[model samples]
Target: MAFRVREFELALMHRMQDLNAGKVEEALHGMSASRAELRAAHAHWTRLAHAPRAPKGAAALRMALGAPPYRGSRPAGSLTCDVLRWPLPSWPGLAFEALLGPGGEVWNQWFVRPEGPMTVAFTDLTPWACVVGDLGASFPGAVQIEGPAPHHWTVDFPHDGRTYRARFVYGLIQRLE
Candidate 1:
């Protein structure tokens, strides 16, 4: 069976369920999708991800999301990586990005701010309002820490002389502390 963008988005939500169940529920209602559908989508994605015969990395993403709208290269330490981005229907301003190593292996996959200026204030730091890049840009010198699970990230930024830690899943903000 072939997976489409909706399934991809559902899979994303599945990863986020642990951190933001209420938000996931709202998204599910917004998509008019049932919990069963979400579970099935995630299962399909997991199978595809692990199947030896299935397309891997960027190819698998292209299979599910179609061709990326943006393709470019970015410097990663001493090496440069190919970056591919595709827009998700639910998040107009954010795009799903995949960083491919020299061998075309996908090193990272997450939502990111597409090329453009992003202005974010503390007031705008609500759940699901922004991506990891938004906070890094808005609050310069923000420190990124790997989260407890895959696709999870925590960014610590300073504001009003206080530090805030924002949790994200798939690079989309889930909550703030």
Candidate 2:
């Protein structure tokens, strides 16, 4: 039951909305992945949706942000508000990031390949960045960082084969150079 990380996230999202959704079934019938793989992921998502709650919006957000991405998911990395160490994800390092607000609401969330090709969100962005779904790498790639003079940086996407640097502020791309 082999499947890509993207597929698992999509299935999990669908299953979260409706446990009985046939989206996974469609994937199986279309041979997108093995029936076993889809079924296992779907089951895991069920447990997440049905997991116990803290009963308050803020508490729930805090709980969810603290909880693992999913059952048995490995630790990825820690959040970096300003100048902090954000060690790259090991190997095919893919991590889901969640930004919380002062009121304990989810301000933003995205998937990051700390050492892979940069997504559009990693470049040419301004205030109120759009939320990007979880993304992963099929093969390991490289990403270079410049500086955060005042909590800003330049992420080089060499894989894109461009001669520009992607500037980031608070993990959101401010512009490209």
- Each prediction's TM-score versus the true structure: 0.96, 0.28
Report clashes for each candidate as comma-separated counts: 0, 0
Clash count in backbone of candidate 2? 0
**What C-alpha lDDT, on a 0 to 100 scale, does residue 122 get in candidate 2?**
38
Each candidate: what lDDT?
0.93, 0.39
lDDT of 2 by residue, 1-177 (tens): 333344445444343223223433554555565656655765654555466852343233333334444322222365332111122121124455444544445444444444433444333233213111111121124354655453344545443454445554334333445
The residue-by-residue lDDT of candidate 1 on 1-177, one tens digit each, is 469999999999999998999999999999999999999999999999999999999999999999999999999999999999999998888899999999999999998888754779999988888988889889987999989999999999999899999999999999999
* Cα distance off (Å), candidate 1, residue 177: 1.1
Q: What 10-residue stretch in candidate 2 is worst by lDDT? A: 130-139
RMSD of each: 1.1, 13.1
Give candidate 1 regions above 4 Å deviation. Answer: none
What's the distance in Å from true for residue 99, model 1? 0.6
Which pairs in model 1 have colliding backbones?
none
For model 1 the TM-score comes to 0.96
RMSD of 1: 1.1
